[model samples]
Target chain A: MPYPKVDVDEWRLSVKGCVEEPLHLTYNDLLRLPQITQSVTLECAGNKRALRDPKTRGEQFLLGAISNAVWTGVPLQTILYLAGIRPEAQEIVFQGMDVGFRTDIPDLLSYSRSLPVTKAIHPDTLLALFMNYEPLPAKHGFPVRLVVPGWYAMGSVKWLRRILVIEHPFDGPYQSRDYVLYTRPDDYAHGVPITEIQVNSSIAYPTDQQTVRRGNQYVYGIAWSGSNNVTEIDISTDGGHIWQPADWIDSEQRYTWRRWSFHWKADLPGEYMIMSRASDESGAVQRQQALWNVKGYVNNSIHQVKVYVE
Target chain B: MPYPKVDVDEWRLSVKGCVEEPLHLTYNDLLRLPQITQSVTLECAGNKRALRDPKTRGEQFLLGAISNAVWTGVPLQTILYLAGIRPEAQEIVFQGMDVGFRTDIPDLLSYSRSLPVTKAIHPDTLLALFMNYEPLPAKHGFPVRLVVPGWYAMGSVKWLRRILVIEHPFDGPYQSRDYVLYTRPDDYAHGVPITEIQVNSSIAYPTDQQTVRRGNQYVYGIAWSGSNNVTEIDISTDGGHIWQPADWIDSEQRYTWRRWSFHWKADLPGEYMIMSRASDESGAVQRQQALWNVKGYVNNSIHQVKVYVE
Candidate 1:
């Protein structure tokens, strides 16, 4: 979908519902508050959707949908504290200005997703004003947007306009009808909502199907896990037959990707498949194949690239 | 491999061997000569190497290895005419300064390739000095490079230094061994050298595994062929089970890619494997699968992208 053009001056972020003090804040009003900057990696839940077998329904995203950026914004908890959340509030719903009609639904709906009150009040969640040191681009979310670190990017709602403190469990389309993993169409009641990202790694150099002369070469890539830091990365040069530890190129950090590299002596001439596997501090290792879901979400499979040596 | 640094002032292009008048021209001398610009598409011979079944030997390039640009250069025929080729000259050999030692060979070898004298003297063959209105970048080839239009990019030798008119066939590694298609280990002698590009097409948008909501959408991509213009492009939304002609978005042109689009009314929700098949003026159509070879060269198969409609 195209980005919605929002007039920054006319835009007002409304915080209502079960809040003790309903508030409408202009862009400048939020900017005047104490701010913090953080480097965070955001990945689409549907990344690597193309690799899913039997094919699932949804936007088929490849590995390129994940990225890291430094964001400057007010803590979401700061706003919630100012508005004073009611004791009965059960969830916080974030709604974006972008809306569309669904083929299966009769009414037009805005893109919205709700988070548990605990997560919404976390200090890490932010009402982001700047990304990579610049005011948010319209495509990302201009004026203001929600940044839910460690979780999939869908929870970081863009073009945000309203925040409602609800007294009951929220069941919006994005929260209940989609983003939830359903094994069978009739199993909607048992569907699980996607949350934390799984441990994952991808090969960036010696791209798939590249031909190289036999000799010394460096194989490198990036790895990330939700909430936890990547502790190790293993490289397999012989089609996963054997694996060797890769050296970390960057220091361990929270909510950001870690770079790793392995020096490979491609001494023989022939075809080989190189794969990277990552493990998080939580002892979570990337799987060979991700469990299949109807929406093809949370694919954290080991990444592989095929190369030929002559 | 990193680009070879050629000091323009110290560099001299030598035309020798079977030439009637051996000549050495400086960078400034070549710059003083008349030049012409032409838009041409250059595709690596190993493009789509990953798509080859049973796997092939070489760099596994995807569909991105092909590109079009306006190249500025002096006609190679003009320089060959100045040097005056001998009547006994059977082939013209072009050599680049980049050299490296191979594990199988004891001596360091420079990259080189040869073309028949007829193709060498063709008016379209060029000694390119600029690409897309800018001087050749070091990564591309600094100072000068050979641009063989209508042929696989392997023929366009980069970091050019020597031009030799030979009385016999050239048996350089690039010319007779690497770029040749070998069906079996013992088929080296009968391996065919890759030449003109085959008719081909690729979907640029609505990438593989992309999910889209049911509605009106445009499926667009590019198509190209060697020498001949693309005559038609057919899009199949049902995994090649059906084919519909696509409308041309760009005027038909020789030696460059043509853009085509199809307006699709996606009324239903399901899985789709969108495919594009292109036919050229020569009546050549993209095949379902390209003929397999050890080097994986000249693959011009129809392109397919899987998408989900929600």
Candidate 2:
């Protein structure tokens, strides 16, 4: 599939359904609103598909689908309030301008998502028009896009076009069926939406399969939680028996990954599985293995790299 | 500064204050209650003091302040129910058998914590009597201990002695003064109790400063978000420009650290900074720097390590 080509001049954002006053606004109208800027991170639901199987299926995202950027936009809450949301509205569906066929659905439909009304009205939710201070890129979502803070990239519907308020749970294929966790033995019947990103950490140096001479060295890596701050990172040179603390550098910026450094004295001449672990404020711990699921969503496990020392 | 020794035969856990029926129970009485086993992770508020400044001014913790084990205990809710908590009770204070003096307090006071009634009566809250299938050890908590799941280790007051149901927010030095986040510039006035363990991650292999030969290498680590699940881990071998995904090696287990691995092919001979980033279900992200506070609590930033390639 190719990225959608949208005519900015012809594009219009429409807010309809379950509102006393529906909205039909052009790009200029959105620009007229007082702009707010925020640095938000978006991660594809399948960022680690390879964790499920070395050979991935459907979409194989090898870390390219995740990024953080400063976004400029109008608060979605302002528009929701101006439209006069009906008290009866239970859901708010955002539809992207990009249309495509899906194997999960019987008919062609625009990429869309139905968010709980409460989530739709959150102050952080935005109808973003810019990425990194520039007009939203075509591939990213030009004209307008929904920037859902603290949620997976799927929640941030790019190339957004329609905002529909409805009275029932959105049972679209992505909502009720596709983007869910089948990690439970019962399968999809008891699955949950892959909403928030999980806590995870990884090593970036000594490129995998890189050999190192026996002497003093160091290991560098980054770690982040979806919305909460990372408290600590531990590094182990001896498989899993012992762990050493790593020091974080710089400021703890919200919605962004933090950097940490550890002094490693690689004194042995053998293959070593250098590992790192991360823990968040909410008490969630990374596992040694990915939770196997039908959809393979939210597979945050411990990160390890095998390195040789000679 | 040593663990208090208590004769289990004579120790009595008293349930008084704001209860319809004040009761006194001994060690044997607690064992009679239906036992439930749970695996919970406990972390000290100062788990990563070395991450701040190597020479810590206050209590220092390296990676050893955290552990997870199976606990056998009776639900705190059951005892609360039997005691008939008065509607006016707003706080539930767990007082440990150990008593000591603190700089903030005028007189000796038992190491204690005040929990909200709601949290005190949570189904998972327990008055644990055994750990890892064995009777609680003296250093860990002898006769009985309050085990508050999903909270920092301080909330699990050891060597339990008394349970006080009070009608107001407990204002003991530990509650209103110590354990609060002094990271804010203004200091203690706006501080918050260090309740839950902050999100954190660590590397377990390639002992710090260890030397490595140039060739193929693997990086490993573990991650956790207090009570939530980890979602993603990104690795960057070339500073921060490009990131590669690390594969989780095992199944996702609750209340435990996860393991992940990355494949690196180091073709050059030079120093490299390997890093990792993690995200959690609660949407918390690791920061680039620790959130500075007077007490330095909840500093979950990204982790990195330095290594030489020759």
Candidate 3:
């Protein structure tokens, strides 16, 4: 998709809906507010879409659909508090300037998604203006983008144009139709909205079918969990038959992936299968099989690799 | 295990038992015969032992317990034909010069394994003297190692010292006791002998949790089958939601792994789960779950990885 062009001089972030004051703030006004910076990991909801069984419909994404960066922005709660959010407001909807026509939808629609009032008031939620210490690139929702720390990237609407505080739920296309996980392919009525990222881990070294000289080798990878911090990582050099605890290479942090490594000696010459399983403080352990959903959301199965030692 | 020293000048390979003619051949005499070279992949029967759910015993080998090498040697059939096998012969037993005392067995025992006469006489079976164009390394069964191309490495008795044509099945410890796969963990009477390698594949690039720049990326891996050739490789960029056919990087060859790759474009910055599933000409497809075995043998489950794109 091409980046939607926005002229900063005429840009205004409109904050309306169930609030005491409806405010229109220019780009400079947002920059003038007290700024904060934080590092967060963002993962696409459809990250492992291709790994789902029975298949799914959408862009087939691999593990590279996620990234981490330092974002600079104003706390979303500050804006909500300044606007004096009405007590009756049930949800806050953020809309993007980018518009597109979808085959499933009759009218051209601007991308938008909603968050509960509780989440909107959370201090970690941000109206981000900068990524990695620089102004956001046009592709990354320049001018302003909503950053929801614990939810999937789909909830973090980009190219912010307006915010609406609604007394009831917002049934937008992205919320009502897309990004909904239908247990049965045809059962859309009981679909569930994808939210938190699942606890997961992946093997990074001695990659699948990688051949290495028989000796000491390090099996490295990363692990992450939504909201909760990753607490343990297990390494299985021989597939999942037996697991040995792995050491953390990075300290624990919320909303960011953790790096881990296991010291392994490939003393014998032959083929091997390697695996990594992760668990989070929330007590979520990476399973051998992820639940099947029509949209292929939230897959956190154990990662595996086949390696050869020569 | 340390390699035992062998005085080549005085060492001889004895062929006896049910053979019509018993014979002893010196190292130089065997080398003078017709020689052939082939690339074969040898896997340990206990490979992926750590992947077994219940956790099997023995050396906790990973995928590296296997390797492919160009072996030069005289076919076992040529030697068997010279020795003139009798019609009553049922199996051919091969023993290594190395001996050891085990806790389970009181007396010293040589590492011995037997093969059916049909497998023993197969033209592909060899008494290998050279590995990758070089003389066999001491640790890799110096002098002559029985190279059973399609079977597990357990059948390839190293440090060849003796061969026997038996009228009945050889009930050696390596055959009836150790290498046997007990289905119920205690069902000694219903155990199966581990043999032929299963069809399998592994991803070698975009390692698990690897962060790559959003652009064109090559997802590379390798696939191999026991006696059959790998006919297809399917790549899934999203956990397993959908699959696309992968291109073969190397032509199909028997007994050796074939390289494969998928050209992937990490156009968007996010997390993705990558997987590779392989199918052989024998109609064997790499499944999501490997069957549970007491010894964790023949695990050919699909391989996966988690990668991040920036």
TM-score of each: 0.85, 0.49, 0.52
- The stretch of ten residues in a row with the least summed lDDT in candidate 2 chain A is A54-63
- Docking verdict class for candidate 3: incorrect
| Candidate 1 DockQ, CA atoms | 0.33
Report how far residue A165 has shifted in candidate 2, in Å: 0.6
- For candidate 2, what is the DockQ-based docking class? incorrect
Error of 3 at A5 (Å): 1.6
User: Per-residue CA lDDT of candidate 2, range A1-310, in tens?
Assistant: 7777788789888999999999998899999998788887777777766445433233534434577789999999999998999999999999987787653444778888988988888888888998998998888988788998878888899888899999888888778776887766445578878777787776776544455667777888877778776677888877778988888974576666767888888876777888888877777767887777765666566777667775
Question: Which is the winner by lDDT between candidate 1 and candidate 3?
Answer: 1
**Model 1 chain B: ten consecutive residues of lowest lDDT:** B53-62
CA RMSD of all predictions: 3.8, 25.3, 14.7
The residue-level lDDT of candidate 3 at A281 comes to 93
Rank order (by DockQ, best first)? 1, 3, 2
Candidate 1 local lDDT, A56-135, one digit each (tens): 66675656889999999999999999999999999999999999976557699999999999999999999999999999
**Over all chains combined, what TM-score does candidate 1 have?**
0.85
Tell me how far the alpha carbon of residue A25 in candidate 1 is from the true structure, in angstroms, after superposition.
4.6
